[model samples]
Target: MNGWSNHLIVAPILVPLVACAILLVIDERRRVAKAMVSLASTIVLTAIAIILFAIESGPSGFEGVYLVGNWAAPFGIVLVLDGLSAMMLLLTALLAVASLVFSFARWHAVGAHFHSMFQVLLMGVNGAFLTGDLFNLFVFFEVMLAASYGLLLHGSGQLRVKAGLHYIAVNLVAALLFLIGVSLIYGTAGTLNMADLAARIPEMEPDRRMLMEAGAGILGVVFLIKAGMWPLCFWLPTAYSAASAPVAGIFAIMSKLGIYVILRLTMLLFVEGPSAGFGAQVLFYGGMATLIFGIIGVLASQALGRVAGYSVLVSSGTLLMVIGINDGAVSSGALLYLVSSTLTISAFFLLIELVERGQDAGANVLAVTMEAYGDAADEEVPEEQGVTMPGTMAVLGICFAACGILLSGLPPLSGFIAKFAMLSAMMGTGAIGVPPTAAIWSLIVLVILSGIAALISMTRAGIRTFWSSIEGTVPRVLVIEILPVMFLLGLTLALTVQAGPAMQYMDATIRTLSKPSLYIDAVRTAAPTGGDVKSSSSEVESN
Candidate 1:
């Protein structure tokens, strides 16, 4: 991390922050100007994320650390970039670009300061991914959540406001839990820096270690709620379903943010200490329950938006379960699944609004009634005839179908490839001669069943939205609105086509995560220039 690249480490956060300030000062009526600024800022963030990702991808993987105010870790603010954070940065940027572009159609104008809030949200997400300390992580989390509160209610409809209020109330409690957990951990470990905390955990006394674990468990609860774990996620479907299309699309990554933190902390804090294997069973069982719940929600959903919302739970549950597995080989596949499912779900959310556009409000109810009662049994059944689909309807239908295939883990898509990778990793090579455990078998069964459920639900929804409503008016969709969906879906296809390289990247990430020492060493040894850098916490203690 030298030269301009050192600055690149902070660009993702700064660009958005600056863009947000600029967007704020601009007249509200200049929507086009604001849109350009926001879009440009996001594009720059995307490019920076790409550069950082490429840096980490080098022959000798590099962890770029930007020491704020030229201060060392555990004493000063630091931003650390590794494979995991860099990958998350890229994912967030990509989703931001797609969602922002889609919003230009109309959603951006539905609310004042939409672009500013959008920038703030990006800044917070990027900062959360880049920050090297738990304290800053909390700061970024609040920033992200605050922006989400406004974004959730961006359109300001009755349903949006109601869902937004619930979303806010739930996350506020999570934030309070965050503060309590951080306080407990800091009191026990005497450090808020993640690397410092990891270093100190192993050396703590039994009682102190127990206290730390309790704090960690509480912290895990916060993330599990964000990850939409069962029982805690009752608000997810309603809130997400109520949000506007682009807001919902960008929100697809918000759940993954929780997963990212859980992955980061689980790898960095609990891997080597006395706390090893902490919260594994909770995540395992919790994830399974969440998956089952999501399956039920999907099956029971009548509206496309609600179905998309439940599908988010399905994605989150899979990731949580995979992380709980704690195998590097399995995590590699989980990473792939994370990216693939996110792209698919974001596309699905965007497509849902378009697919349901101009649809009769009672279409779903009528479809259900028709299915149950056989249409009066004798009301002169009309012979089926081929209908020429409009170009827009055809495109929406194709996108909807693509979403279904991806969500259901059907063949020839990244979703199937990801699930296959995990299953294969668990099964292992025949030469190993070790069979998977009953738990693994259970996971396999649940995963397969979830996919089947998604397929059935998606098919049913597709029939109601596309086929049964064939006589309905075609939606007036703009080229811009449809392109974002197409772009996101195309990425999933690219992931499928380039599964080899994508999995290679994920494998490297898993390798890095499996070894906590690598991350600890990188952060602890990072040096700053331009002034006298303070020694790390360990050096100060030694002195």
Candidate 2:
């Protein structure tokens, strides 16, 4: 929190923004140059994110709050980094590395400005996580969405174009809602700084508070739409399923962006005021419906891409449900689950294209037909033996199975550990003595059922793609292509092995988030590191 370390707080945003500008000047034909710049920038970001994560982890509470232009909070912009934002920054960086590396195999060259857009995306996502005010959050959100529009349509096809159009239209509306909400909240509170707003809400006049709540409610709708909550998620599956592999993989974290905002605002703005627990019921019921909808979508989906898309829904619903529970202990587990699911889904998105490369479009239909009726193979046919599996097929099969295990929340993976943590926290197993309520039990049932649904759907898809293909040909996958998938899955394995320390981190994170005063005080008291202006501003603010 001093000198250079303080500057690192803004490096995550500035690095990418500078890199994006550098990328914009490079010729489109210089693909390797562009890739190198993008990859180097992302790797540096990953390093900075790690350092920030460590700094926050070592601290007891909020520590990295940087005031912009030597101005005080409620007057100038600020960037705050605590356990939650640090973790998210690290997650986004990891995903960016994986996705960018995977794209270099071919996807990077398929469209113009892919590297530029990718860097812009990193800037936007990083900025969203770091910003200390709601208006800046909207600015970063729009930056993120604008970059995504190009990424979604990167490989320009009819399917991608159609999905991208729908994606753009929906998000544009969300952006508008975001603006109206911010305007109302500012109109009522006279400020947009989150910490200032949090401080004022408890003391606001009742009538103005009511208007603020209405604005917050509108903002919640916008977040839910981004989070892929049911009835507002009609566009997610199509848009996700149509993108190229790496783009889709990176896109996985975008949904969690919405979840991130919801968690932050709920903890900071509504934790202790008239707005306490505002929109909890809507989140609860909507999450339940979303879980059920995702289950149905997974079961009915024949395409692997669509299944991955629906799986995103399942992840979002579960997180929203956990938030609705409103327990800090439960939130710790939810954080673990969020990281595990995002990584798993990203790996799955990258793996899908490889697994289905050799299969015919009609293969799924034929497999279903065989399942409906009896297998067409003759009963007299002898079983084949000693037919050694090709190296490519074996590698793909292993990765695919790993994805299945993670997605289905099966044993011996981070996914299972995360869910178990949440369930245990829900059951009041450690230091928490409250019995499970009807709603908690219902969520428990849905969580288990969602796992089962995922298992069935993934198993079916796995068999059809790996076992029932008539071509029986291995895909022409390169080392660069498959390495990213394995690298991501490898991270999940690491998470599983380090669950003990990981949960400790989660526990500390929740402890910080559960106390709104920690965040509010950190932002409010953060002073600029300069000459007399900072001193004057600090003295005036104190008065």
Number of the predicted model whose lDDT against the real structure is largest: 2
lDDT of 1 by residue, 1-543 (tens): 788888899899899999999998999999999999999899988999988988887234546888887788878898988888888999999999999999999999988999999999998999999998999999999999999999999999899999999999999999999999999998888888988888889889999999999999999899899999998999999999999999999999999999999999998888776889899888888898998899888989888889899999998888888878788888899999999999998988898888888688788888788779888464775875896888998999899999999999999999999999998988883339987887787788888998999999999988878777734789999999999999999999999999998999988888888787877777777777865545666584573
Q: Model 1, 241: alpha-carbon shift in Å? A: 0.6
Q: For model 2, what is the C-alpha lDDT against the true structure?
A: 0.91
lDDT of each: 0.89, 0.91
Cα deviation at 313, candidate 1, in Å, is 0.8
Question: Which prediction has the highest TM-score against the true structure?
Answer: 1
Candidate 2, RMSD to the unseen true structure: 2.1
lDDT (C-alpha) at residue 297 in model 1: 89
Record all residue pairs in model 1 with backbone atoms less than 3 Å apart, i.e. clashing. none
Candidate 2 off by > 4 Å = 375-385, 429-434, 531-543
Consecutive 10-residue window with the lowest summed lDDT within model 2: 532-541
Question: Which residue pairs show backbone clashes in model 2?
Answer: none
Q: Write the per-residue lDDT of candidate 2 for residues 1-543, one digit (tens) a residue.
A: 788899999999999999999999999999999999999999999999999998987348987898878788878898999999999999999999999999999999998999999999999999999999998999899999999999999999999999999999999999999999999998898888898888889988999999999999999999999999999999999999999999999999999999999999998888787889988888889999999999999999999999999999999999998888788878889999999999999999999999888888788888788778877654354568988878999899999999999989999999999999988877874246666888889889989998999999988887777776767888899999999999999999999999999999999998888889998888877766754334432443364
